[model samples]
Target: MSSEHTPPPRQQPTFLTAVAALEAVVADLDDEGFGPALGLVGGLFGSADPSEAAAAGPRLAALLPDAPPFPRAHLAMVVGACVEQGADPVACSGPVLAGLRGALTGAQRLVEGWERTGGGPLPDPEQDDPAEAHERIADPAVLDAWHAHLAVVAWWTLHLWQRAAWAVYAHPAVRTEARGSGVTAALLGLIRRYRGEQHDLKGLAHLAGMLDDEPLLVLDRPTGTGYLLRMSGLSDTFQLHTLLADVLIGGGHLPGVPQDPQVVALARTEFLDGRRVIATGAFNLVAPDGSWLWNEGTPSDIPVVDGVRTLVLDPLPYERSWSAGRFIQEIPGDLRLERVLSPAEAARLLATTAPARSAQQAFGAGQA
Candidate 1:
């Protein structure tokens, strides 16, 4: 309820969302609320307009004084993020850099009174509040290791997300036990790829949107580093980060076979980076009424991919979440559609009173 808050750019679609997220954490924060600002850091990193993003530098700078290295380290990083997002470098520049320059000149050590002022649960980079990672430490060496690593965080441009993962692992104090803690293992995967190593495949979450749904694709088969997410890899998008959730997923579909090396090579093209490359997955969409029907020529996990029918996984409830490849796929995997449906289940839940093929004169293909 503070009057001094920097007003959000109302033109941006997520303005209300940003306010809500901030309010959820600390409702009574005034303009200078450092904790509230950090909780809203996601909004800052995700600013869509260049002019809006330009304000991030000084905004984040305001928090450095009241924060630990966790946030002080973020001071320089905010500028780097704005640069990557295409904000005008000089316009986005602010007095924050002077403070950033001065802070780094000191030798790294645990803050003078972290034990008295610290010790909390570790935060989940994806789901929890970013400022909640502060907690006191009994292990001075590990705390010192965390202190040194966090204090030195720079742009880390290509994978800015590593900064957060590194922050969490840097604190083994088990602080801010929010939820979801795969960040450390995920980071090691980055290290492995940096060394030119191989990783096994798992399902990856394929994110989507309204008809113009799902972002684009990137094939990450690399000589120097490995892929970010595998097509047949892990389906959970949090394998990246929340920032990644909005930025990386959903590249429009390009048809290919997973077993063919040529198709796989095509998938690795630079065009698909930070986007999804298709491999026989159905992006079946349904109406708000829970009707899983689509007219021909609409793109995505096509209900019919090259003659094979797709099984729309859990589409009885129409929504965007089920539109990803993981939810819709070529018929036959671990899931099977049952012929047996109770009259109520089909008529009400499935939105069909009877099977009418193609609604031919009101008797087309549908529930029987």
Candidate 2:
């Protein structure tokens, strides 16, 4: 067909019409309607006709006024469309961004104010304490709403980052603007937060191991520690594996392994002293039965040492354990010491560590 004669795709529904359609779909919980709504929104903004989009902008802005916004999947489709049309995503949503920032600031201030008033302790179901009843009168629902709002906000922010990264990866203009405006740092921050909250090591590993760019790794080290015990160097392989283990262990998703002799041997030498065993570098252990124990936790059934702090196997990998709330809430109160590796140091080590040789290379060198 001749280019001029070929019919153009059907024009997208008007912006207000699309928003109404979306609200209807959500009200009916119509999964099928969602796709069409998204496509329509994308088409409206993504189209070459700026006048059409300009006319729709105010209506769309009015419909999306919340902070840490919602219906992010739909918003992302719209943003993607704007990006495709060679329009600035920020410019298209300038009013919405201002509203969002204001909403977020207000929400944060409310949370801070609540926290300042000592927002009362979590209920002690065991005691049914009289004080707990008094605390409940202070509108616990407000706290719940605040937390839910924050979670939604966090999710939308991540969606924005993901869309931005997708745009940068595909659009040269996006790449230029992103690089100029410190969008990379924002993207990384979102990725880090997502990884921490969602236990998504694979996603993080993919981003961290991107071949096109040097990954940013932050390191923290303890002073007055023995030099030999301090961690150094960065290895992508190690970092990826460490993060994988952390996510798995923290989520309680590790698989069981049969007892092996090599595990016993390593346990004897590496963990014999009963001091918290920390992995200074990544290493594979072979059980006596010739089975591999690539990533495993310390024996869980063993009784914790009395008066001993944490027994951190790799502090950097489990830095989340060091958070004040985590330490107070998750760790046993009696544990004498907290064993946490510096996540910063671990990340640094991972960045600097030499690439591991392939199995073939090791065998060829007679070092397997």
Highest TM-score model number: 2
lDDT of 2 by residue, 78-138 (tens): 5445444554554444333333333334333333434555754432324554333334333
lDDT of 1 at 270: 20
TM-scores of all candidate predictions against the true structure? 0.23, 0.30
The window of 10 residues in a row where model 1 has the poorest summed lDDT is 201-210
Each candidate's lDDT (Cα)? 0.30, 0.35
The C-alpha local distance difference test score for the whole of candidate 2 amounts to: 0.35
Which candidate number has the best lDDT? 2
The TM-score, computed over Cα atoms with residue i paired to residue i, of candidate 1 is: 0.23
Estimate candidate 1's RMSD in Å.
21.7
